[model samples]
Target: TKEHLISVEQGKQYMPTDTTQNSLLNLDLLENSEFSSITRRQFISKWYSFSYWIIFAIIIISYLVYFILSKRSVNPIEIRRRKSTKIAIKRLKNARFCLKNRDFDQFFEEIEKSLWGYFADKFKINSSELSKETIDLYFDKRNIKTETKNNFVSLLNICEFARYSPSKDRNLQMERTLEEAKEIIIEVESDIKKK
Candidate 1:
């Protein structure tokens, strides 16, 4: 506040006074001989300037692309989720071999594994948490079709039942169950794509 305050001193002193209206000028604008001179400067070539701008534009575009891609980087979970069906199908191929070789136990085991593995990957469910209710939770959350859900459950049940249950027509059952499982996977995959 003290610094901001202004101090003023009052004083008046006079000794002489003179007033003059007419004064002679020392220099005149029109008489100057160097006033009409022109200035010249060096200029770069058109191609050189053009190339500079083009390179700058490319650098800016590339940086923007890098930034955008980095910002939208892929999620590992999403990658696994998208590839779940492919993995399941690959597992089914192994099961198909078992079926062809008449290895019934391995065939059933593979079937069960593929089903559980597919659900685990697709729903992001842990192996320890694999159960009908857990599968149903994700199915209901994702609103999977009732038909697809039923097909999956039925095939799973048959695979589990095949482990201990002796049947006269296991060959037919294997063929039918494998086909149903494939259909169920394809149906769910198509549903995933639609959404």
Candidate 2:
């Protein structure tokens, strides 16, 4: 009987006469006794789920803060100024290529646009609303040299005349105007650097 009891307690075998031992075990369980609290698999599952949520929350919050700060710190004026300069340079290069190809129409248009864009960038003005008189005034207010100012004015005049008049010699005028514009750009850039 003792051997049977030992075998039953070890869970190797059970006998129908072990009713007293089974009742004792049931009473022990009813008293809130725990043989094992949490298994390794259950603990690992809970820890993984908790860490996953924490990492996800951190990533989302970080992106939200970045977006908020970037939105508030944007500078439209600086962006416009940079874009104007880039456009001017690209137009100037295109004008040079057109001049080389004897495309007088495109050359004149691009050169005029480039000049207007350059002035807009230099004076922080809107190119679309700019006029020759406004450009002259801006240069005058900035104390630009008389020679440089006159050269710029003459270049603009040639661009307008060549576009509107349409002469066979317009190609030569475009070449001369492009060179003049390049000189003005160099002088203006130097002036800016000096300031």
Candidate 3:
């Protein structure tokens, strides 16, 4: 190749210029060679293997996800209890909205709904069957903290009193009451879970 290049530089136009025999670089071409005879078998083997693994992994992950979700929600009663606080907090948010609008009556109504709905859902009891004594007995049976029960009673008393006699600090009182309502629901749920 060097000799051929030197001859070309010297204007030797008639000289044989076969450079492949002595060229410094090795050339690779796949056209019409052993490498280019690609069969569908090789391609399908790889493609099927990759697709099979991808499908297998998806199935396994889906099964695990389904198992976890189904196991968590298997028991309707347990699901109710676990979601009780979340549901109650949602109701209290509506109460908070009512409070923001200074709708004292609606605020109290929402508070009552939050508490009653929380207990009913948590204990799987009917709302109509929920009285002070019934709640006391439930708490006593579950051995919930006395202070928590007293706080619950205090929240009820505040709601009851506010409905009959109007208070001067109505907005502030309702805010405190809403917070207390949320706390009572959370406390009761935690106590039951603890047991």
CA-lDDT, candidates in order: 0.80, 0.79, 0.83
Please state the error at residue 117 of candidate 3 in Å: 0.9
Candidate with best lDDT: 3
lDDT of residue 176 for candidate 3: 89
Worst 10 residues of 2 by lDDT: 1-10
Clashing pairs in 1: none
Model 2 pairs in collision: none
Please provide, for model 3 over 92-140, each residue's C-alpha lDDT reduced to its tens digit, 9 standing for 90 to 100: 9999999999999988988988887887787788777998887788889
TM-score of each: 0.65, 0.57, 0.67
Report the C-alpha lDDT of model 2 over 1-195, residue by residue, as the tens digit: 355434334465754578889898887676564433444557788989999999999999999999987876597666666566577778889999998898888898899888888888768887576987887788878878778788887888888888888877766677778888888877866665565
TM accuracy, model 2 = 0.57
